[model samples]
Target chain A: MQRPVPRRSGGGLARGIPAVLSVVSAFVIWEIYVRVSGISPLMLPAPSRVLDQMVQNRVLLWDNTVPTLKATFAGFALSLTVAFGLSIILDFMPRVRRALFPIFVVSQTLPLVAIAPLVVLWFGFDLTPKVLLVALVTFFPMLVALVDGYASTDPEIEDLMRSMGATRDQIFRAARFPSAMPYFFAGLRISITYAVVAAIFAEYVGARAGLGIVILNAKNSFRPDIVLAAVVISSLLTLILFSATALLQRTVLRWRDVEGHR
Target chain B: MTALSLKDVSVTFGDIPVLDRINLHVEQGEFVSILGPSGAGKSTIFRLLTGALPLQTGTISCASPENSFAFMPQRDALMPWRRIIDNLTLGLEVQGIPRKDARAHVAPLLRDFGLADFTTHYPAQLSGGMRQRAALLRTIVQGRSIQLLDEPFGALDALTRTQMQTWFEDRWRAARWTSLLVTHDVREAVALSDRIYVLSRRPARVIAEITVPIPRPRLGRPPSAQAHDIEAHLLEILLHQTGEKP
Candidate 1:
């Protein structure tokens, strides 16, 4: 952990301080606005009240958080599997890609409110509906990223490989797959965020547990503080998942980041 | 002995004739170049050889067909994710050599290519000339005698191009591999090739074959008058084909 850091990533302290300050100052301003305006906690909770609600219901929050995280991870993994399978098939068969890409795009345009409850109705409201909804929302980005990545390789490199007696599979392994990695990571970064939000939305459609249920319950009961607390937890989860994706990309694609400048 | 020979090769792209009954041959331990204007189907001939494009009509025979040619493309085409060593050894790996063994085979040559210290560095870490050197090294380390280069250093700046050309000319003198270079650069063809084949523009046909009688280490001395005369003649033939200046 104490290893000498390259200037690019090592300047994180300089880069992060302003963002941290901006967020902190936003919360401070919110706290002051609530105090000065004397807002009713039911209508709009103070930051302090939300913090207290979070602490008081910590056990309940933790229990609900487990289910949300479970749904997110399960759904995200399914998305990755299906997307990878489709992208590879599309890579090999352009006809298949041409036939299916339009359908994939049209799937993204489907209204989630119209679709999520139907998925719940069909899959019966357990972990299955949640995972299906997440996969439906998240798989497209990863799939497109992978397809584009595979196609992005220079044709000259393919010829070079062939002249050296490389088979199609060999060309893919040596050139296409490695070339596609950066795009794949970019897709993962996008899809992971969608997975987290989609998980919460899955619960809102009809799940028995999760932060979405907590928020919905609190909203009905006029406990804005509880609603805001749940919102904060979900946001934090999204941030963590996004950061983890970034870290994974930096580690696996180390060659791109060598010498810091590139 | 003849290393590779092409007989009556002709290509037409959907009835637009690209190459027309071209006949050429390369001898073992010789540096040969095909000089043509940009779209004279010089690349079409290469594409046919590499099997990127189907052979419309041709008989290409190699003395040792089992040995694959080390082909260097104009783009350098270095895999960015791979370190210079891994990139240089990629051809060996393609030929079914294990990665560790390939690395061992290329380790001794990296230094001579000016990439010894940079072997473990990624391609993005190297300069344009260095990356081209690494690409050339990758081509040679396959242990193949025939090298097909399509303007391998054409992307570099003038100074770097000259340096690489000089370095490559010296290497060709030492090793004497059977090579076929495809280029539109007249001076480059005259500088490095033992013999140059000039091709006419579209519907390309072999117009002339000129042998360089200049002495070795061609770049070692101020290019002799004979080398310049050959270059001017080749340029005149190429210009006549392009209808640019004759």
Candidate 2:
């Protein structure tokens, strides 16, 4: 999509070519190394073999991808909404922020490996557990970014707004919120990548359909190529989510970029 | 006609007293300045006038309330994210005026302030002088009769500050709003203000109030003899307040 294009002219192709070339070169070396070294396909699949398996099982891969994508988007959306709402409440009420902030930190300290299975046991094998896992993993960064953004707002601007008869809500809307936007996007980028990983991990523990299930099935059948194929798909999904966040950041925070040039 | 008055005002932040029994007033259609050394609580007086700092012990009576006055602090304080015109109309927007109407209202005044072509430009694009001019235009467009400026030109380069001083003086002569300026610069206070009040160090109290003996249209090379005399007198008072030999 045109939306994916980098904002600067000519620089996009100049910057993108090197990165694309490096990945392609890595795959080429890997393909050649595996073939010449006489390594067993069971241990490490050759790049070409993985590509072949991917084409043969395209329908299966696509079917698995659909469920993972759905879970990730649903969980990411839930996390974003909840984080935004909580950050706003914490910004206005410092006492509440103080009381709840440590609890949020403690929540993050609980390993997902220990908690994901419990979440699955409680929610059954439905999408609920996967979604909750993603939410739990992604919410903290977004909340911290927003709270920090709101707190770091320039006091002079706030004072100007207040002197102009702006109410507390007006100051928050005009000054605090806009200043917090860049930070929010920073958090969103982090959470987005985590959301995808969390969704797959949740599925690995318990899910009827998804790339995690495909990987598990391939591993049991000793189809290393098929597992690698699913790994490639997951990697692509993470890249897409990451790039989309960068594009959104560029669009919304254009002023910051303009200021830098000047 | 006196526009505003603060009688026997005293302010303390925790146990530290900022302004002690301060008394000052500005007349209608006059430019008044408060001159003091740095950290003499000059800005605290402004904060009090704007109602940003609550009145500790004082009687501050303005012809208009705090909200009805335009206040410009030392910093330009323009919203970097907003275009020049949008930042100018922000106050109007806060007052329940529609954005379109507020933009329209400021559109004509932009030419007067030399910012007609830069309406869409962000604050970062402007020079120091241009930013201060935009800030001043933003304040003036509020249509408030009382203006409280706290060292508005203190951030600019010396050349820019001088240019801004002349520019502001020309405008003030044409449209005399009841203006109160707080600055540590003696020349700035002398060049622009009709009356100047010199304040002492911490727990600031007015030590001298000198009315400019020079007549209006006080601009150009080699100021009047009276202007020179007043500047010397104020400088001496400031030196005395700071316990420095001049």
Candidate 3:
């Protein structure tokens, strides 16, 4: 006997109520805290002032955001290619996995804050450093997730594939790779959040234009509202990227999600 | 000539022996079962036969090539992402059959397998018996002369297992492929197998080779006294292997 799969009743908008409520409550609390604490605009701009500044300087903010977005996407794309390549190679060659996995772990331990400056020193004030920083920060998690995914393949399924006269590549394409999709998306969700932040951090160390530069400029000019506006914009970009990853994961892995009800 | 034969097959893991000089055979179109309690190296034999594990010291000869047998493991092992039709046609696809041809080949068989309507459904959407039915169909559509079934009904509940045992019997009788089943259940062995090879625990060896001479369609009527005698004798041998009184 089997348990019937529970049908999903509400669509996205219906299920989005709790999330909307939580966000509204959080914003309300922040607005109240700023007004009651009587913080000066220079020290901690009220939510209303930050919102006003964001609207007034939307053009300037958007102009700087273009560079940060480009760097993040560039680095994220590079990281995806590298991680996919390495994970496949390492999965096929256990010796390589053994030799390189430790080195990758050590690479992650190198703090991005420390490494970003050095990367900028070498790559200069162009987009390369920011892109490299984003790639460096996001690579290991996706690689680890993929490697573990490949390793965790059901041996029985692999054996079944082999018994059917499937070659190594056939087994990989049919069983190993498909099984790893969920883990890949999960890794992407985690790494996507880091991509934008890493880009901003690299820009903070050195950049001609970006959200990092915008924040740095606002800070130098002692406009806390503008700084907070940049901060809000950067965070919004992260949220947007994260939500996009989640939505993509849901679409691709719609089959797996049904296992929850089962 | 026998459809498949294993002579002096021995396997060891590190210092521990798993199967020792095991020999068995299946005649063409025969329903054979290797019966033993759990940890009897039943799965080890399967792995060796399927070429997943190295055959340490024995010779395994089959009428067809190594890949000529379709295997159904203990778990359904259905790809959750694929629909029932896709899962059924996986073996054909892996053997270089194009998806279109594979689908066309498997589509007609789905109705006989009682999975015609469920072709578009995912594995998660099927019942335990239905999933196993689909798995069995998947193996058969591989166009293999021999089928290796490793406890195909082991995961089902007792009631479903009984129902499936009969259902599988009917299917086997109709298809009549050279089939080898590995299971620990004695009644199942008596009910389904034309011949049963009772095995000892670890480092498995053939303890008894009992032929079930009962007539076909053994499920509809009460099992004959001859079937009971065979079941009892097989159980006694199995219990003896485990150092127990039957």
Candidate 4:
């Protein structure tokens, strides 16, 4: 007998309450720890001090954030375009897939920190190197996801299509691409976070502006509050990117329910 | 004219033969069943007919071109992402049939197949029986002259399978398309087929060809003694082929 599937309600507060409380609790603990320990504000500032630093330097924070955001978005767009094109090429040609798959695996092994300085020097600390670094880090996951998705398509379905007189291009458009979507979304979610981190790391090596530069300068000047504020902003950026990807996934794959449960 | 002809057809994977020197002729609009136990290479016959696997030896000929043949697999092969209407029109779409025209063609079929209400629902949202119906709808909309079904209803329960068999008979009689079904169920083959071909185990060879004398829509009504006698005879033949004593 088929069990009844439960209808989901889009109750925002029901889902948000727990997450909001967790953040609140963490802040409360941080406030208590700083006050009770009597730690110097320079070494470990209170959450309030971080908030004050954010408000006072809001203009500076915004100015630095724009460059990092620009690099991350540019890199992400370039990576997606190249990765998607490469996946299509590889999917059609098995020999190319076999030849390039090993190269992709080896490329991931190159150390980011060691390569970042050379990239900065080569590109002269401009937006180009930071974008390239981010693209390098983000491309592999999307490529791998697409390949696995293409491979995992059901052979039975493909055979049925062939029997129906569908050409190879038609089979791919109707069946193979749609089946690979969930996997592509999963890879995108992972890569979005990595894109932001890669951009920041590149900025840390050498950048005239960006949050990473602020953090490094604050650490040298012994201003822990400014460093914490920068960290918080970066985390917020990561959260925003992740949530957007998730929303896109839900909208695109609205037809498919998550398996085995509501 | 003969719809399908297999002359000395043989299939092998490496050294082991799956089908050996099989010969048969299916008349146009006739419903035939290739009945056998598992590993009898009944499915290999369907694959060969559909050109999914290459013919190793001898001549395997279809009166129609590749596009004129439609295949239904043992399991529901519906795309989970597509709705029933879109799924049914997949064959048409792949043939470069315009989406507007395909939808128009499939609209009447949705109502005919009792799937009008569920046309917008995805395959995952459907029951097993409903999925099978949707699959048949897709196959029928392909408008092929020959349908190759490999145990299409084997996965359904006893009750659903019976209903599907009756539904299939009604559709087959109405559509008048030639069909070659591969099945292990002796009673099912005897009930639905005009003629049943029994295959021997492993390197499968045609052992017997028995004509089913029962009329269309056989089941629900009490079985006549003649139907019972024919069923017993077919069963005995199958048992002997599998080396079982009656």
Report the Cα lDDT for candidate 2: 0.88
Interface RMSD of 2: 8.0
Instruction: Please report, as a residue range, the 10-residue window in candidate 1 chain B with the lowest summed lDDT.
Output: B237-246
**Model 3 ranges off by over 4 Å:** A1-5, A9-11, B244-246
Model 2: residues with Cα > 4 Å off, grouped in runs: A1-10, B244-246
lDDT tens digits, residues A1-262, model 1?
1113244754778889999999999999999998999989888888899999999999999999998999999988998999998888899899999999999999999999999989989998688999888889999999999999999988878888998889988998899988899899989988888887899988988989999899889888989999899999999999999999899998889987764634
Per-residue lDDT over A1-262 for candidate 3, one digit per residue giving the tens place of the 0 to 100 score: 4456667777979899999999889888988988998877798787889999999999999999999999999999999999999999998899989999899999999988788889999999998898889999999999988998887789889999888888999988888898898889889989999999899999999999999999888999999899989999899999999999888887888787667631
Question: Residue-wise lDDT of candidate 2 within B1-246, one digit each (tens)?
Answer: 788999999989889988999999988998999999999999999887777998989899887764658889789999988888999998898889999999989988787788998888778778889899999988888888798898999999898888888888888887787899999998888888888899999889898888886776676667888788888888888787788542
Model 1, span B1-246: residue lDDT tens:
998899999999886998999999999898999999997889887777766777778788888878547788998888888878888888889889888898989988877788888877777777889889988888888888688899887899999899989998888887887899999999899999889999998899999999997888888579889988998898888777788542
Q: Is candidate 1 or candidate 3 better by lDDT?
A: 3
Which wins on DockQ, candidate 1 or candidate 2? 1
| Candidate number with the higher lDDT (2 or 4) | 2
Q: How does each model score on lDDT? A: 0.87, 0.88, 0.89, 0.86
Per-residue lDDT over A132-230 for candidate 4, one digit per residue giving the tens place of the 0 to 100 score: 999999999999998888888999999888777667787778778888888899899999999989999999999999989999999999998999999
Sort every candidate by lDDT, greatest first: 3, 2, 1, 4
i-RMS of candidate 3: 1.8
**Can you tell me which runs of candidate 1 are displaced by over 4 Å?**
A1-6, A259-262, B244-246
Off by over 4 Å in 4: A1-5, A9-12, A258-262, B244-246
Error of 2 at A42 (Å): 0.8
